[model samples]
Target: MKKSGMSLLEIVISISIAVVIFIPAMNMFSTTGQAVFKTRNFSFANSAARRISQRLMAMPYEDIVEVPLPGIALFDAPAESFFAPFLNTSGTNSGAKNITQADMPEFYSYLVQHDFRYSLSVSNVSFGDGDEIKSVGILITWSENNKNMMYRLYVYVPSL
Candidate 1:
């Protein structure tokens, strides 16, 4: 009998080869997707940190809240928030006054959706005279794929 189409064995072999090639391709695509997600999150954290830093720089030296070392934990907690005015607090407010979902709905929403949180801390930097400058630090933390990540922005603000 003359063969008109692929034999069963031939077909099976071809399918097996295709599967072997496609499986790795699919896995590569999945890995690429995860990398993109990670990059996106990093970018967002960077942008937000810069923005918050800018805000801190623009404010009067006295206006910025000053907390001792480890004043605000790097984690999310309303009571110990770094951005006081922007923090959303419950009735009879209590916390560090950091950024929150209530005070900053849009920014907070992005943080909430991305599982990001931020905290701020300020320490006296005695240069020449009394409280001539302060060291400000903003900490942004988030969880990605069950891993914890953080970004810290620190700068010195001279009294203006």
Candidate 2:
């Protein structure tokens, strides 16, 4: 009598070959997923930075100046005021001067909940012809997979 089905040894060899091919394919899929996640996070950070920059540019020239607030570092005052509109209240003096997670708008709180932090700074810089302009910088930082990532954006607001 002749057996028509595959032998036990043949079945074992086929399974081993399938595993060898399957391992690499599964690894590739996992790597692709990680890359996509990182890219999405990066895109969100970049958009946040740009939005902050645009807000800075739209402010009046005088409002963008770094004012020295007592017991606080320079530029802190203007930075806080710059973000004041996005706070829960309409007035700058409605609450604490410092920006905390609680002071963030709904959209910003959403970003914060996702582990993102941001900072805004404006400094005076001299361009060609000795004209002084306000250079606004926005920095966005986030953590991903135990790694820290940052994105920075700069915009110059000329005197009006």
Candidate 3:
């Protein structure tokens, strides 16, 4: 009677072919996962930067200039979130609402559990013939697989 199963050589050859295909397929999946992770971090940075920028724009020019947040070196990754001090705090000024925990969703919480860090810079700049504007810069940095990633946002707020 004819055998219904493959010989040992046939089985080994088939297994080798499967391995060859599986290795590249697994590599592709790993690469895609990294890309998704990187993209997610970038999206969060963009939204956080926008939220911080808007907060600075809403504040009276004096506040931004006088009470700048602690600065972070662009290349150094801090052990904690730099914006933690500015979050969930009530402002001394009446009708002033500094960013609260609810104001920026997942901002503080994510930083608490993640490597993401941020910094803010407020500096005076001459606009045309007048010096009544301040340039606000927000830097967001994080590490991914031992690689550093950063995002920068700039907005100008006029003295009020």
The candidate, 1 or 3, that scores higher on lDDT is 1
Compared with the true structure, the alpha-carbon lDDT of candidate 1 equals 0.70
Off by over 4 Å in 3: 1-6, 65-110, 126-131
In TM-score terms, candidate 1 sits at: 0.66
Ranking by lDDT: 1, 3, 2
Best by lDDT: 1
Candidate that scores best on TM-score: 1
TM-score of each: 0.66, 0.61, 0.66
- Stretch of 10 with least lDDT, candidate 3: 73-82
Clashing pairs in 2: none
Query: How many clashes does each candidate structure show, in the order listed?
Result: 7, 0, 0
lDDT of each prediction vs. the true structure? Answer: 0.70, 0.65, 0.65
Ranking by TM-score: 1, 3, 2
In angstroms, how far off is 121's CA in candidate 2?
A: 3.4
For each candidate in turn, give its C-alpha RMSD to the true structure in angstroms.
6.2, 7.0, 6.7
Cα distance off (Å), candidate 3, residue 160: 3.6
- Count backbone clashes in candidate 3: 0
